[model samples]
Target: MALPSVGTRVTYPAGDLIARARVLHVEPVATDDGERLAVLLDTTSIHPVDAGWPDQPADAGVITVIDGAALTVLDAIVAATDGETLHLGRDIPVRKGTEGWAFVVAHLVDAGSAIAEGDEVETRADALLRASLSRGHTACHLASLALNRALADRWTKDPRRDPLGSPDFDAAAIASSRIEPNGSVDRYRLNKSLRRAGFDATVFTGEYGADELRAAEASIDDTLATWIAGGGDIRIERDGDLLTDRRQWAADLEGGTARLFCGGTHATSLADLGDVRVRLELVDDDGTPTLVMTTRAHAPS
Candidate 1:
């Protein structure tokens, strides 16, 4: 089957959960559990988990065919192709926007499914799940900024600054970030590289370490609470509707407006985040000390 030459248009960035689209292509793909069908659509509202940064998982949803049949989407992933072969998720070789390559959203379904190319379909993402994930994602970003501010004094040397004008500790130290329903966990490494960069990790060790950690957590919570109470407007800005287009998350906070390059969906405003809090922990990662920040969002009723 011929593949799409252009990147798939996406609507998830705008918080869209449902869309009508036409099937552009279908290819059988081999997986660990055997074969599955990779369904490509001309446009999709489903938010596929990115291979490059799999922080937020794919949106759960189903596709309804014109004949009244509905097929559950087992998984949705970012797939890329050069018109000859389809590469799904982590298997993608080149970076997005590579010359002559098309980035698309591939909805994985049962192998023997009846979905086919040229078929008209209705794609619907679970609204509740999307909303929950959006809240979590927004909370995650806010917590990162608050954490940066909380640790600003620890940076002895001048380093990069975040959108909020604090030393960019989150960007410099983040190892992994996972967004779950109503919450997120971010892990940061405090190894020699960070120490060399003038980040004082000693504040997380020794007798007074626990006390210091608690103070930092308290500071982050206070900041988050104030931001949420301010109820600032939040939005995602994008260069285009295509999957590979540049996108950013922007918010108006008490300090000022902040923007960061991000591709995940987020809550419409700070008020939607409700009460946000964060817990901090220091753990040993293979003899190296690591910092874990867990943030939770309690949406207002």
Candidate 2:
């Protein structure tokens, strides 16, 4: 169909499980050996993976028609537009905010499905899975900040500050961050440049994994405990209701607040994140040092 002019309306921000929407556009996307169909709707509840930061995965959901027929929402991703064409995923030629471009969530389905433009569609996200991922993502952020603080004294030179204004070790040396169901794994590279950034590798290399990790967990859990006990709100702050709107994960701690520019779903408060812990491991890669932080959490019963 013709390129979409605007962005898709997403409903997952408010913990919506389903939404009634009108299909605004559909296109045949060619995959290996087959053709897949992409559908755009006036509104949806599925969380699409952003092209820039894909920390949390997409929600498991299904699309249905008013007649009770359902189509599996196989995959959903952030798509961009320049008014002249619709770009899917990393294929977007220009960066976001490249004047006159609209961002959207492109819901992909099997080609030749009966779904078409203007069809009233219902999008639903798996609530259980969403909750697990939410916990994992929240834990990930908390753990990173705590880890940075735990190693704050190691940085001799001034470095970029994190949300808490400490030396941003996590931001500097982070190699990869993957959020799993109720847990996350983050790796930090200890290369020459990281040494140049003034990160002490000995804490992980020589003999500081267990003690440092335990200390980090204690600090983080303490913060989370205070936040949970204080009963403040935790929510996703967004600029617009559209798919590519600037959003931040905001948490109101008892003493202060932490706001990170984020594009993932999160829990409502620290109460929803129960019993969080982390494990730090040191692995050497052909004479190079790597620190892996594994964070896990269990939601309250």
Candidate 3:
């Protein structure tokens, strides 16, 4: 009737490219770029950009109304309502699962869209792009795990462990992660705090730093190759169907089942990853030394 009291039910995690949904509310939102119509749906297969992580971006898609008029979805983003007010993206004031707020996916269409509240609609995500992003996202996670293992010996002190039981260097140092078509770019901050945590940064800073980096890259590449060769099955497990519901990327590897909390779409199995590889680079960000890992994969044809 009004803004929903619960989160939007999401279907993309299950690899659905299309979904039938009902428009719960339609309102015009004034953004920095201008005004746009925000359509709140009862359910969606279109993956929206998460404001908190902003890693894997919103899926490109379109919504078809009953009259067969297709409205191009310019963007989709996470939106929330506290019963009285609606907030979008970074404008949301409270953390997810707050006492009374409902988190939903807001599909942005042109202000001139004739779609209105209570309309039944069908949302479709571009199949090719979805496949590419899924591959990139899966590769990104695998690459992070491989990199952590490659750098495990450098952590002198006991830090947290990842799903694979390696020192969680990726979690501890990651500054930002972005998923691209058939690839991903992740940046980690190598600062004083990392050294203070007993990470042997000297190896990456010493005269033989180049050699050490090359060794690490080779190790990571080999690990990925082995994992891919095993053809481990991959799937997304979820606690519920809602947008804010807890979901995980679960991969059944040769070693064991590794599960990481994730909110992105992924391939159904490792066989869809094709060849996953990553290149490591050390860059300077302002005055801080940063480690940038660029992961790429051949898209599954």
Candidate 4:
């Protein structure tokens, strides 16, 4: 089969978890243990883990053939290819949306799977896991906005503002973000550079103590509660349905509408995020101080 000239059409952004698609191509990828088969579809609802910024993991799912043979998808990843070669995940040499390149979602199955090109398959994601991840991703974004507002006074100079018109602390100081089941962990660096940017790192251990940190946490919780109580609508706006197109996560909050550039899935409304809370901790990484924020979302029982 010939490699696709255009990017794969993805439906996951619309909160789709199941799709029926035709196999476009299949190839064998050599792994450390052996070789694995990568199946590409004309269209897919399975969310693939991004290689550039892997904050949210891939969706767990299975592909079933028309003949009733179910093949478990081991993993899903972003794959890019030029006209000459196909690159999987981190192996790609060029950035996404490069000229003469096509980005695709590659579903990895066992090497011996009986699936082939031109096969009609039904792609299904684990609904329970998808729902949990959606909640976690939504909570992660909300917590970041609340944290920015809480620390808005810390910046002496005007920094880049977030969707809520507050100093973008999460964007400036974020080192890593990981989305987990019903929760997320974000790490921020309070090094010398942040101090030069007018952030008062000394507050963590000097003037600001555990009491101050607790107060900030409480403020974030209050903001989250207010937003959730409003039962605002949430939706994903996209420029197109292709894998590499731009997508924005938008929510109608109490103050106004907030939108942020994101590729992960999210819940349909703030009401779906029940009892959101965040815990803040300041720790030392070698000689540098780091701030960790752990956010959790408890679904309504």
Candidate 5:
């Protein structure tokens, strides 16, 4: 079958939980004696990983047919093809607009299904689960900005700026960011290069007493509390619906607009967050210094 020539129109950015769509393609996938099926719909509300980033994982859901039959969507991933063969997940050869390729969301199901091309499937993501992930993702972003601000004084040299217009400590030092159900873990690297970049390494007070860490934690909380109470608006800005399209997290704060290029779900407003907090820990793992920030968001019932 010919591959889909255009990107999938995604509705998840608007907080859509369910969508009725036409099956554009269905292909059988086999790996190491195991088999799986990839289903592509004309439109989908299920958010897929960008393959490029993969920060926030896919939402849990199922596909329901007109006859009320359902197939549990075991996994959802971004697939792209160069008009030759469908490339699933990280196997995509080139970047998004490498000429003839079309990017799509590949909903993975059990192999040997009766589903075929032209079948209409109702796609639904678990709403409560989505909400929890959204909260986690949003809180993660907020914590990053706060952490950057708390560490801004360490960067002596002029560095890039963050969404809040502070020195881009987070962007420069960040290693990985993963979003979970109602929380997230962000890892940052502090190494010699950071010192070479004029970032004051002494700011990390492993040698300092407990009182200093507590004071720093209190400061971060104060900053977070102010931002949350200020009620910043959260919105995702995107260029297209394709899985690899450019998207950003825009937060409207008191002074100005704070935006970060992101591919994740988020709450509509800070008001949706009941209590958001973070715990910062500094650890030396295998001779490499790492900073871990754990963030949590409590949703009001």
Candidate 6:
């Protein structure tokens, strides 16, 4: 079968939990666990884990046919091909949107499965898991914005700003970000490079470090509390529906509307994220000072 010429159409961004699709391609792949079949679809509601910036993991789901047994979707990952070769996850060579490359979602199923190309199927993502992840992703962004606002005054020089006009400390020093169920964990590198970028790292290292950290955490919590109380509407805006299209997380925040480029599912409103808070701690990673922010939110009933 010929590889798809265009990116997969994704509907998860709109909080879609189910999709009707046709199998475009299927390839048997050998892995450490066992042989798995990679099923490519014409369209999907299952969210795939992006190799680049894999903060949020793939959605848990299954694919089925009419009155047929469901095939458990082991995982969904971003894959790309150049007509001649299909690359999966970290194996993808070129950046997204490269000319003549088709980026698609590969849903892995167990080996020796009965599914085949051209078959009509239904993709269903787990509602509870999706809701938890959506809430987590939304809380992740809100926490990062709050953290930036809390540490805005710690910059010694004029720095780049985020959507809310605060210093872009999160973007500047971020080492990694991971979204968990109902929460997120983000790490920031407070090294010489960050100091050179006008960030006053001493406050996080000096004798008053503990006190400063507490104050920052408190401030962020307060900001989050106010934002949640405001009950802002959350939405994902996109230019197109293709997998490679640009998308943004736009929220009608307290002060103003804030939009951040993102490629993950999210909650529908601030009210969906109940009681968001963060705990900040400093850790030494091979002699480098790293600040970790652990965010948590009470699941909405």
lDDT of each: 0.94, 0.81, 0.92, 0.92, 0.83, 0.93
TM value for model 3: 0.98
Better TM-score candidate (4, 5): 4
Write model 6 residue lDDT over 1-301, tens digit each, in one string: 7888988999999999999999989998765678899999999999999989999999999999656668999999999999877899999999999999999999999987888888899999999999999999999999999999999999989899999999999999999999999999999999998999999998889999999999999999999999999998999999999998999999889999989999999999999999999999999999999999999999666
Model 3 lDDT at residue 113: 91
User: Which of 2 and 3 is ahead in lDDT?
Assistant: 3
Residues 14-61, candidate 4: write the lDDT tens digits. 999999999989999975657889999989999999989999999999
Residues 1-301, model 3: lDDT tens digits: 6888888999999999999999999989998778999999999999999889999999999999877689999999999999777899999999999999999999999999989888989999999899999999999999999999999999889999999999999998999999999899999988988888878887777898888888988999899889888998999999999999999999988789889999999988888888888888888999888889999998556
Residues 79-153, candidate 2, lDDT per residue (tens digit)?
A: 887766777887888787677887788888888678988788899898998899988998888788877777888
TM-score of 6: 0.98
Question: 1 or 5: which has the higher TM-score?
Answer: 1
Model 3 C-alpha lDDT versus the unseen true structure: 0.92
TM-score of each: 0.98, 0.91, 0.98, 0.97, 0.94, 0.98
Query: What are the per-residue Cα lDDT tens digits for candidate 5 across 1-301?
Result: 5778988888898788999998888998864447988998878889887667778899999998778579888788889876669998778888877888888899988897768888888999989889999999988888888887887787789888887778877888888888998889988888888778887766674576345446656777777788889887899999977666788999887677888888788899988877888887888867877778888888777
* TM-score of candidate 2 to 2 decimals: 0.91
Candidate 6's error at 199, in angstroms?
Answer: 0.3
Show model 5 residue runs off by greater than 4 Å.
31-33, 209-212
Best prediction by lDDT: 1
Give one clash count per candidate, in the order shown.
0, 0, 0, 0, 0, 0
